[model samples]
Target: MRDKAKGDGTVKPKVYIAEPVPTFVENYLSEHCDYEKWEQNEKVPRDVLLEKIQDKDGLLNFGSAINEELLEAAPNLKVVSNISVGYDNFDLQAMAKHNVIGTNTPYVLDDTVADLVFALMLSAGRRVCELDSYVKNGEWNAEIGKEHFGLDVHHSTIGIIGMGRIGEAVAKRAKFGFDMDVLYYNRRRKEEAEQKFDATYCDLQTLLKQSDFIVLLTPLTDETYHLIGEKEFSFMKETAIFINASRGKTVDEEALIDALTEKKIFAAGIDTFTQEPIQKDNPLLSLQNVVTLPHIGSATLKTRQQMAMTAAENLVAALQGKTPPNIVRG
Candidate 1:
């Protein structure tokens, strides 16, 4: 580690970037402060983070948990800026207790993630992966039978669990492109969404039972952990398609497994998982009706550049004794 004091005779704010981001973001950090960065391909091990953070005033983090244990190890830490929209990994209360601020990149990746959610919905409903496998497995010698038929997406009803920015984007696509009816359930009604897309607002149970497609887009919070469980699955129509582009813990994995195995719903397209890089033996992988993806909702090159830039700006602002633009409150 270099000396904490700079040539200007002032202590340079030491910043530790947990993961490698865009090159432009790295350049910005290097110009502004004394910064240490982890390699792009792998996360910094927890032990290294604990040791390095002791002298850091700011942290640029991606996907690592920020809690009391981490905060206790970093007495000088003043801010944590996450390069993603979701901040469920942050323990806000712990940060507040330590007088540290939290910030996240939002609005930049909404359209990119919305596009992925719509793609997942279409693929799951149409059995795109299954049939591709069927052809590659040499089962295409004869015309496919009625048993291989998939469901229609256009003119169907889609119930969105959260009416946030990305949810509104998905609703717009469903309404404009697919001519589908949009139903949404949120704690508070989205009047503009209803006015813009002719979307209907309803209770959770009503949305679950009536829609032909169900998409979960709620953020992860105490109130929303395992929001969809066994009873929630029972509410869906037997032919409905389920899509989750939100946090994995929002849905109970075991219940989802049972729902798919028993044919409670037609199929599910999942982007997030309770455990990332989902376990090898996870039952969802063995199910024919489930389409699973690594959590790549915000993985587009352009959007990621924007997110990294935003996070860098946030970290710089906080370390300079200014309030971060996208600060997250406890």
Candidate 2:
């Protein structure tokens, strides 16, 4: 499709949206530029994206790999606006080499995701889902015993890895709502967090050993991929409850399976995973001590709409030769 010329004789850029966006975003795009959107529930096929992007000036992408090959295919592409906080799906170096600016929606879903993290922690720690299954399975004839009792959340020590925005939000809840002792390990000590939550800065080993709950909130990177493996699990208390709301590659999934099977940790609440749409045969599904979700950390309706709008604004800004608010600078 050709760029639509406005009454001012300026050509509006052609944008390709890789996934369906909210109606408001669609309206904005239609009014600002000539655009084509993928309306399927599933991801746009790699072939389809490559073909459609051949003449696009910008791409509104989500969960699609943007690399040298894709960039080379879209010779006129100048910007890629991702509808997610993490751009691990993108190759930053390649984008830079191709002179393609990248943007992501950040901070919009922080509180919503933090809320889900806590929900996972509480559900797993209390065996809420397991007991719900038991009751529904007609196995609640007898009164529950101490053997089936759940762990306590209040007054417990929680160690958080990667004390970023979402992590800090989790800390606030842990400190204010549950009276938890929050210990955090980050690249550097955050004095503000210390003052606000009375959080203690601790080494990973110490945190693992002392904490009743361990929450992984780190981003996935070369230094952090498989950061939590066998050795790290060994450092945890046998009664420790592990929670992973971070990237899947950050944890060694097999090692985690072993830890659970060997009873190294009490239980785990996992959102992200090594593979998305985790296979039905995945062992975690069969384990009673595990609570797994389909990576719905930021799935709230309002948050999703906000993210789509933010992403649309970023794409529009970049296409209009203005700096987007959330540009991913290397």
Candidate 3:
């Protein structure tokens, strides 16, 4: 509350948005604060994030890395708002140590991401991309035998790596939409698991071995970083479809490429990458079994609008000497 007025009593506080929010959020933002948005999809460089936010009380960031090194440049920063559900890009320990509040947009993206998870599962299960190419290349009439065949989802087994809000939504959809067996692997076993969708809890190794489709839904943490390595891939069934909609660093890309190239796994689908914009010479680019996306898990028009507005509200509230709606820390 130290720097509230922007030269006039009615003028709003200054809020720096590392990402450009949709038009829907502008009105809400104008109500409480004036915002500076980055015009492009590029991440704000660390020095720029610090320099621009040095005097600002709050910031609305999307995938901007706000580590201790970066935060040192912002002594006036009161709150950091992330438009994403995953805050791995931010350094929570540093923020907490510095007494800066951090918030994330979570519930809004849950369903959207769950939907994406199922979409990847279905695309892999049916060989959608491979066959689409075949048809486009006028090879549909050819003798595409069992080698090009796919699996049936109904009565099949599904394994989810994380059983959080998104995971639960995906489980419910799989249980009802395909009548599939749902097995979830998480740090802790949830109770609604059995009550809601009859989801069973199993160790990572067993889940990988049993699932016809393995979906990754966990956030990236030091402990979970590269949690899926070569050894983990070795435990999977050759026919198991691996779908990663979670943070890309959670998986070891080298092992994943080896698995796909060696036919260790049936197919793979990825909506995120260890590096964003996926480098021009990334190794996974050439794989026919992999389906890559530009991180569109929460890209629905309505969901994105809601997420932007929520993130704006969080910054406004926190900087106005109030608690944000979705505070990330305890």
Candidate 4:
């Protein structure tokens, strides 16, 4: 259904929201555009989104692929606003070919994601999830001994693979909260991070060998796909704890499974996976040393709401033919 015209008979821009958003964000979008939304909490089905986007001038979603097929289906589409910081789902070349602008919510979730990284680090290092299950299953009847002990995070060396805003947030926690020595590897050295967080910039191999905990926070790109595989794992210390809060494809799933199976690394905390809703038979699930999450890195209510609002603002700005604050350039 089309929205009623304004006082001057000017119709609002048409938009499709493929994911449910906060009421305030809906109200904000309503003020700027005529929108149809997928009301359910679940993601909009691809066919439904394609159909709904047929006449839309803007789209807002999280992790939906804005590829050739979708773009072809939406000849009127001018913008796609992603509610998450990562835009790997975007087919930048296709979007460009279709003359569509893309934007993402960044900075808002930096601290939130950094917190999850630390949670994963601590959970994997201390075997918190494993121990919790052991106690719940009545396996803790006997007094615990050294076998129940776990690695100490305080004063340990933490190597961060990405030195973006979220990585800096993690570094702050490592330095102030745990007094950890921070080492980092990035495409380009961040001098500010080095001085502020007392982080030492090193190559990937050096960081892998020296750090007690290695955290991967890099974005997924052609260059980063399977960046950490068997060869990279071989460089890590046997006592090292690996953490991935970035995209799943950034590390090789098979390689990670082998590393854990062979005890090449002591433990791992995985958030994003190569496949969402990870398959039942995936070997990662069977490993006691691995702590897996359903990719709730920026899932806090406040952060999600903020992201929704930011995305709404971006969609509105782009449709209005103004430059969006966070325009994503390939």
Candidate 5:
């Protein structure tokens, strides 16, 4: 597809937006490109995106897979701008084969996602959601007893798997906000994090067995797929509360369900799942000791807008033959 010519005979990049963005983002895109957008509340259908992208130079979307099929459909495609930080949706091998650049919004949502992870941890540890329902459903006709008791967050030991930017934020909260002890396991040790948060670097097995709370924040990759499974779960203390604010596929869903069902762990707080908009029949939904959310770790209004803007800037920069700041390399 050829670039659209401006009235002054200059060519403007043609872009397609597969998801709705704030009016401000649209205005920004308008200043740099000739673009078309999906205006509906729901995500643009895959078929429609393939069709619309045929003549586009760049695409801005949330988590669409950028594989050979999509690349072949858009021969002129120069870049794919993902609104979220995780680029697992991108098939880097295929993108590189086609000489396409991929970018994601990072750093912008670290604090917001960290806030949700802590929210999940507190909700699960304190049984806030379960107890709230207990009172509203008239199940708490009298003062609650030991059976309704929940764990405490402050002063507990927290194990963070896959320490990164968000993990550092969580560590800061644990250390100062709650006076909790922090332990972390990552591909590489972060000395800065250890010094800043008084965090102890340890092996995965050690972290799992010793911490009162376990949080998974690893990015999903071939190596990290199902990083935590049955054996890993068995290592945790029976009183441990597990939280997953990262991609769902990083943990084996069936192993998690088994651990929860058999009381291997006290409870869990999950923001992402193996399957999104989780099926009603998923056993996790039926567990009283679990707190679930709809993958909204970075869903705050202000943060989301910033992410969109970052993605837009990346797309515009790549289309203009400049190096985008947040490129995802294979």
Candidate 6:
């Protein structure tokens, strides 16, 4: 029986990429494990997933939701490798209950995400997108109005929520590159933030009240869901700016639209939304003060490839019963 158990430990571990992983990522995974994909484009069918994942030794998943019900089906599953940095789509407590180790690729796209954050900040504050539209529609010389002038980002106060890796990176951009005072609110104090960015760690209320630009970088969790609603917006300066490169559900969409309509805030740059692909009739999209993106915070080719390779490497390591470099949830 001891010999059989040893053999079981050494047996070839099957690795599954729930979605079609990139070729380089596949090659990287192959360097360490026996791997195959489940789907080419869209998600593999639910029945197909339920049937195929039953005996998987390890799984690398994407946007697909993995809950307790799915975990129950995979008796041999030992690990989950998430392609994205955010793992809210995966049931962490349920995975822990099943003795399943889950890993996410964080920090790999830190700079890339920070770059996009600043890009949105500049575009929104300077009205870059709207100005470009004006030129495209032959209205370039018609912008001599009181409200057409853009806000000054330099010498402004930048408020950040969620002082995580991405949040810290955004601070560097605002404080260093744009010459802004960095104010942040986290669940706890970030001492290193003061040393690095000269950030003023304050209560959520203080940050909202003081900042000229509010940047959201928090992750999606129960505590953060709808974290920025009307009460928070009421405190923002009328000339203030807001940008969300974080999860969509973090902000109250209705409140944000109302803020834009009433001119409570000067402008906004939003990437993620309450619903992705933002329905055609979404009120926020109709607002002139808001600039929206298709949730491409880490969409640069170089960064995405690196994230995929990192996820693949972590999955391979977890499949072989080794400690993955970026394992989350303790």
For each of the candidates, the C-alpha root-mean-square deviation to the true structure, in angstroms, is 1.3, 0.9, 2.4, 0.8, 1.3, 3.5
Please rank every candidate by TM-score, starting with the best: 4, 2, 5, 1, 3, 6
Which candidate, 1 or 3, would have the higher TM-score against the true structure?
Answer: 1
How well is each residue in 1-330 modelled by candidate 3, as lDDT tens digits? Answer: 344565556546677888877876877886778667677767777777777887777889888787887678788788889888988877888998888899999899888898888888888879898889989998888688998898787799999999999999999999999899999999998987768999999999999999999999898888899989899999999988999998999999999999999999989999989888899898788887888888999999889888988888888889788988899864
Per-candidate clash tally = 0, 0, 0, 0, 0, 0
Question: Model 5, range 1-330, lDDT digits (tens) per residue?
Answer: 456787888999899998889999999998899999999977678899999999889999898778999999999999999999999889999999999999999999999999998999999999999999998998977888999899999999999998899999999999999999999999999999999999999999999999999999999998989999999999999999999999999999999999999999999999999987799999999999899999999999999999999999999999989999999989
* TM-score of each candidate structure, all chains considered together: 0.97, 0.98, 0.94, 0.99, 0.98, 0.91
Model 5 alpha-carbon miss at residue 25, Å: 0.6
TM-score-better candidate, 1 vs 6: 1
Write model 2 residue lDDT over 208-302, tens digit each, in one string. 99999999999888999998999999999999999999999999999999999999999999999999989899899899999999888889889
List lDDT for all candidates, in order.
Answer: 0.93, 0.93, 0.87, 0.95, 0.94, 0.85
Model 4, 1-330: lDDT tens digits are 946676778899999998999999999988888899999887788999999999999999898899999999999999999999999999999999989999999989999999999999999999999999999999998888888788999999999999999999999999999999999999999999999998999999999999999999999999999999999999999999999999999999999999999999999999999999899999999999999999999999999999999999999999989999999998
Weakest ten-residue segment in model 3 by summed lDDT: 1-10
lDDT of 1 by residue, 19-121 (tens): 8888888889877788888885777788898887988999999988899989999999999999999999899988999999999999999999999998898
- The C-alpha local distance difference test score for the whole of candidate 1 amounts to 0.93
Superposition error at 304 for model 6 (Å): 1.0
Candidate 4 lowest-lDDT run of ten: 1-10
Error of 5 at 63 (Å): 0.9
Clashing pairs in 5: none
Model 4 residue runs over 4 Å out of place are none
Task: Tell me how far the alpha carbon of residue 216 in candidate 1 is from the true structure, in angstroms, after superposition.
Answer: 0.3
**Leading candidate by lDDT:** 4
Q: What lDDT score goes with residue 279 in model 6?
A: 99
